[model samples]
Target: MTARVPHPPIEPPGTRVRFPDPVLAPSHGVLAMGCDFTPGTLLRAYRSGIFPWPHGDEEDEGGSPLVLWFSPEPRCIFPLEQEPHWSRSLRRTLRIHPYEVTVDQDFAGVMHMCGETRKDATWIIPELERGYRELHRLGWAHSVEVWDTSTGERELVGGIYGVAVGGAFAGESMFHTRTDTSKIAFATLVTKLRAAGYVLFDVQVENPHLASLGCVEIPRREYLGRLDDALEVTPGPLL
Candidate 1:
């Protein structure tokens, strides 16, 4: 059975809270009030469309108090009902490459690779990695992987990972190694999500690639309204 998540009381606008440690709570939803950034605390935040991204030293034993909770305004969402716009060049590349797509396979590897390849400082620190891995074990988080079969070796070429609640998929991060690989993975995932009867694919933020894929921004108020509808329906596991 899935764990029960409780909706916490809303925090006042413009109020900042410093979260330094993770909170381990059985409730799989947001804590009403806390300054902890523990595994359970992050888990609860994601379930409520809030994510803790802290910036600080990688090896600092004391850890960092510089943190921010993000719930993006004008959230990006893909229109899965519309036909996915695969460019002719992309289609040609697909024909030549013929990559295979897998879901929920090598999620930890994907997360690790994402962290390892970080050129800049990363908020997905060691603790965050362990936390998400635990969430993956609990089936609250998942990854979509793209594979190159010709090499007979698989690397996490491109994919997206995020939390699922009811019929909503809150996209966290997506990375790609090959051209259009991430786009392919995203398009395919959107197709699968549509088949599963999901109503929201919260891309969280927008960029050129996501915009090209038909992701649009809506006001935060409108997004929460949509979230309400999305949480009412049941959808299948992302895997």
Candidate 2:
């Protein structure tokens, strides 16, 4: 038997990478599986309108769980032209201005908190965590941290984290330890993205919480078209 040869690493920050057409993906939305999480690979995947959504503990060659690349039909995204829906209570929380919002301050802390605070999911495995951490170090991943400043000491109460490419941002997960803190963090992130001229805000999938914040689902084809346009833009750095 011939020995298996490793593939070359993906290159460049904004290079386009081809992926299986999402239209041909199965009902479960997995476009591919079992790839390493190098920064170039993640950037290539995102640039191709795909993202990893690994589940289970089955280790791959990198001691990480087998990764699943997904490009779901009816992809959920936040429209860059409008503000997120704000509830009366959330408006009140914003008016009070009780928390300090910072960007890229504590990405790993936010990620770990998000994993720990997920309602009924165990998707943020250790291997994925390391991958995103590396992305953060390389300026492709970012976190919006919400801090409780009422007690004179800054305490992290909530945050949101995600990957960025060109004018697009893909929000991975968010968590809150205090009331409306995560919402505050998300709103802060959106504000920053908009100010920086981001054209797309891909939230991956919609949940009740995301829908409440005004995310909308569009056909994968439309999403791909928009993603293509987004990648052509050169927005200011999100961090």
Candidate 3:
């Protein structure tokens, strides 16, 4: 892969600006940006197609200030018009699934589980958690939850969360305790997004898992163009 040089910060008039990929070095396939990830600052970053990902302590401060900014070369996205591959096994699981799906329920709990690390320590510190929770409260961020009656009402099996800007839904993280649970939640969310006229589902960076679900990459310049169009359309509720 060719190394990209990070570009100097472009202080544009609006609260949004794209961080040049060439100047921002990626670590473990991610990048870092933003001085303070407070709710206000983080919101501004997402609006501009920038997001914070937790990084190692060796490269960043111990907690709140440690996340990195990333702009992947081939941004993974699911187009609204295309049908993502839903395998026979996955379809069977969805049909026989005992889990019920909900939106924006237990948003904080989902975040807590996502931050937990059985092996390495977590980077979603107190400040980051609080900030995202605030975004949820303000209706700018949301969570898709999967629950099972056998596991009890409070037990959430799978879900995904992210901030929604205009027609774009920037997916942050997802977790699942049962097979195909997260996939079901994601497929349902996509169905809702498409029905509501959303044009873009920004997965940020691409991975093999996302590729299997039909996500493809576009150049940063082209991504910015779609983002501009997406931001002009109104968003639909996740529920």
Query: CA lDDT, every prediction?
Result: 0.64, 0.82, 0.69
In candidate 2, position 216 carries an lDDT of 91
Q: Write the per-residue lDDT of candidate 1 for residues 1-239, one digit (tens) a residue.
A: 12322222122122244432223222232223323544456555555556655564433335544455666555678766677677787667656667888777777766766666556437667766776766666666777777777788765677777767667788767777778777777777887788878888888778887887778987766766777787787776554
lDDT of 2 by residue, 1-239 (tens): 11121112223354344668777886567998765677777888888788988776666777757778998888999888886677888788888877788888888899999988886447787878888887777677888889988899888899999988878999999999998899999888898999989999999888899999889999988998999999887777654
For 1-239, candidate 3 gives per-residue lDDT tens digits of 11121122122234344455532444333554544655566666776677776644534443335666666565778777677667788778877888888877777877776666223436676767887877776666777778877845457778787877778889887777777777877877787788867888999888787776667887766776788898888755554
Model 2 residue 185 CA deviation (Å) reads 0.6
Cα shift from native, residue 148, model 1 (Å) = 1.7
Kindly indicate the candidate among 2 and 3 with the higher lDDT: 2
Point out where model 2 deviates above 4 Å. Answer: 1-18, 59-64, 119-121
Q: What would the TM-scores of all predictions be?
A: 0.76, 0.87, 0.81
TM-score of 2: 0.87
Candidate 1 Cα outliers beyond 4 Å, as residue runs: 1-40, 56-62, 91-96, 118-121
Question: Whole-model lDDT, candidate 3?
Answer: 0.69
Please tell me which predicted candidate would have the highest TM-score against the true structure. Answer: 2
Q: Rank the candidates by lDDT, best first.
A: 2, 3, 1
